[model samples]
Target chain A: MGQFFVFIKKEFYHIFRDRWTMIILLILPVIMLTLFGFAITTEVKNTKLGVFDPSKDIATRSIIQRLQANEYFILKKFISNPDRIEDEFQRGEVGLIIVFPEKFYENLLHTGEGQIQLITDGSDPNNAITLTNYATNIVASYQQELNKTAVIPYQIVPEIKLLYNPRLKGAYNFVPGIMGMILMLICAMMTSVAIAREKEKGTMELLLVSPMKPLVVILSKVVPYFFVSIINLATILLLSVYVLEVPVTGSLFWLIIISLIYIFLSLALGILISSLVNSQVVALLISGAVLMMPVLLLSGMIFPVESMPYLLQLLSNAVPARWFIMAIKKLMIKGLDVTSIYKELIILGSMAFFFIVVSLKTFKNRL
Target chain B: MQVIEAENLTKRFGKFTAVDSISFDVKEGEIFGFLGANGAGKTTAMRMLCGLIKPTSGQGIVAGYDIKKQSENVKANIGYMSQRFSIYEDLKVWENLRLFAGIYGIPNRKINDRIDELLKRLGFESEKDTLVKSLPLGWKQKLAFLVAIVHEPKVVFLDEPTGGVDPASRRQFWELIYEATDRGITVFVTTHYMEEAEYCNRVSIMVDGRIEAMDSPRNLKNKFEAESMDEVFHKLARKSTRTGD
Candidate 1:
């Protein structure tokens, strides 16, 4: 136990002594959380909206006011002619354009129906769709208000309520992903590189010749990295909750339990990678290619796994981050119970066991 | 008593034999020089004796423990230093010493005293808090040697420990080895330098994974009718067919 503590202390000294390593270990998580939370957001806020209100009637003006009322849209322009709407899009000033047809209130009041044309830049399909949806919701709410005052008894209003996250905040979606990514970065990448450094420096040879068991040495190397990942987990949780305003809605206890399992799995993967490779560069490359790419692309962190091709969806099952992100989304956002995430718990737990067993078996006790 | 004894010890990777049926013994407190060409299997044999690798066949005993079955016990009684600088460059000098001493199971109470004594002997008391990366390479190598034997092991294995040192540092390193042997610790060292062989009590020359000559440097020179150990080595190593490691 004393030897183990000494080894862990030496490992910590190695981590803290290097300026860049210390920065990457401690500061990288916060940077990534902030970057993913704010910069790479999917939520379309303050979209520049161009309007062509040809009718300029009271009802049209009221609907326009309703559109510009919320934080999601800001009316940027009022085009005089329909032909100029295309020019406004070409100017790249607005992502969406709402063209209220002539006699808009007349057609709506007398004929009991009106046609409003919504023109959007199709170059960015998703943003175009989101902006259109927000505009449609505003118009629908205006129609519903008109129904409340006037005696329109049979009109339909499809009340859309976004569950779990009502405002569709991107932070809620990425908080779990950032947690998975940050934990994997610290546990898998850092631990493998640390072990490979000992090999590259020829210190592993000296270590193996000592009375200390190789298992103890490996555990000692992993303990410091494990702690770093835990600290990162705390940082990510705190940032997401306090800074980004994405609270942990589910049981924090089960959330922590699952995260601990995922951390163990990542650390085991790091040990397994270190066992196969003998140099720091190779270890880093393998972990980056094998761990980072899958976590980013296949884990449904940034991309929805349901929309991916069938083969990629099948391949995503092998990525451990997929299950972790899923579980975190359920716990942190949906605020579900422990029974809701038993599948993720089992998969992550088994992966941790498998990696630990394989790494121990393949660990080179001899050279 | 023999601190290290190997009889017909061999190691094979796939079909290629690295150390082939080598046999030798080193008495306690003796400086045994293991001389070889680059790919001549000196490291493999040394690793087997140090209990870092298992021999493919035959037997090795280090400090009265079998290399194959009791490797852990063998490790407990032996120390190893490589040509590569093995100490942590990022750690402070005293931290490195304390780490190794603690890992070797030296008592926590005694580790500070051991570090102080070692630093005093090396005249490195002032540099105790200095990072090892800032130190000169010669000092790092010397410090590595001291830390390798910090547990006071029965035998110490040095694999080309003076590979890239200056002549003065190399001479000083030999003095350290002499000092270690005086304390009854067996020194099993491998080197490429022939002049260093003259300082060893017994020297063995290896060619193509087999010991070609084993005796004192004087006996090898007398038998080969050569003026120096370098010439004796050349006469024996010229018959080799092996290439790069």
Candidate 2:
């Protein structure tokens, strides 16, 4: 036990003593969270909208006023004819077009009914969806204002219930995903490079010949990274709650437990990579290039899994980060319990066990 | 007393045998020199004796432990320094000493004392604060040697320990080996420098994965009818056909 402590202290010194690694470990998570949360956002600002109002009446102008009052859109073009909507869309001059039909005001005043069509460019689905929703909300509010004074015999009233996120903010989605990403970065890539450095320097032989068992050597190398990742986890969680306003409505303790399990699995993977490679550059390349792309692209961190093809969806099932992102979303946003996250816990646990077994076997086999 | 005894210790990688049924004994407290050409099996035999790898078909005992059955025990009682200067270059000299000492299970209270003794004895008192990377090559080799045997193991293995050090430092390294042997620590040293073999109490020459000659440096020279151990080595190594390792 004392030996383990000594080894851990040595490992920590190695990590903290190197200024570059310390910077990456201590500051990189916060920087990434802040960057993604503030600078790199998916929420579109000043989206271009083309208004095609053939009615040229009071109700049409009121509807456009209501849409313009919101900050998400700017009326970039006013299409005189309905055919010009396609031209504006194709020219990329506008993302959406609102067409109020002819006699829109007269029909509304006489029968308390009118038709409004929303046409959006589908090239960018996320932008198109938001734009259409904004137009629908503006039209609905206009109808509500008219109904306060006028009589409408038949009305279609729809109530929207936002289950977890009433505001539907994008930061809430990325905070949990970023947590998984930064954990993988610190635990997997950093540790693999550190161990490979020992092998490159030929110190691994000295370690192997020492009385400290191989298991002890590997565990000691990974223990410091485990704690560092936990620190990263804590920092990211605090930023999500306090800065980004993404609360952990579920059990925070369970969230930490599952995340620790993930950190263990990532550290074991790092050791496994270290055992296979002999140089730090190769270790960095493997961990940084090979592992990073999959964690970013296939893990559904920034992209939705359902939107991917069938083959990719099946491929994502094999990515542990995808499940972790889902599990964290449940815990932080949806406020689910431990039973709700059991599947993710089981998968992460099995991965941790698998990596430990494989890395130990390879470590025994390799130099 | 023999600290290491190997009889018919063979290690075969598929069809090619690395150590071919060689037999030798290393006394408890003496420098035993192992010499070989580049492709010869000195490293393979040393690894087997250190219990880094199991022998294919042989019997061996190191530090009163079976090389195969008690591999971990053999490891616990021996130290190893590779030709690559296995010191952590990024670590300060004192920290390296501390790490190896800790690995050898030295008590925390005694670690600083062991380190101070080593620094004073190696004439490295001034370099206690220096990183191994900033030190000269000779000093690094010496510190690596000192750290390898810091646990006071019964036997220490040096595999081509003086490959790149200057002649002066090589001589100084041998003096450290003499100090280790005087303290009853067996030193199994491999070297490319033939003059280093003369310092050993006994020297064994390997050719084509087998021990071709084994005796004191003087006896081997006289028996080969050569003036020095260098000629004795050439006379035997000339028979080998295999190339670089």
Give the top-scoring candidate (TM-score).
Answer: 1
Report the CA-based lDDT of candidate 2 relative to the real structure: 0.87
lDDT of 2 by residue, A93-167 (tens): 987788888898888777667888889878788777766766676677777787787655334645343468755
Separate DockQ for every predicted complex: 0.86, 0.70
Q: Give the TM-score of candidate 2.
A: 0.91
- Listed for every candidate in order, the interface RMSD values in angstroms are 1.0, 1.4
Compute the DockQ of candidate 2.
Answer: 0.70
Q: Which candidate comes out best when scored by DockQ?
A: 1
Q: How many clashes does the backbone of model 1 have?
A: 0
Give the TM-score of each candidate.
0.97, 0.91
Candidate 1 — which pairs collide?
none
* Alpha-carbon shift of residue A230 in model 1 (angstroms): 0.8
List the RMSD of every prediction in angstroms: 1.6, 2.8
lDDT of 1 by residue, B1-245 (tens): 99888999999999999999999999999999999999999988988888778899999889999999999899888988988969999989999889989888899899998889878878889999999999998999999998988888899999899988999999998998898888899999999899999999999999999999999999999999999999999999999999856
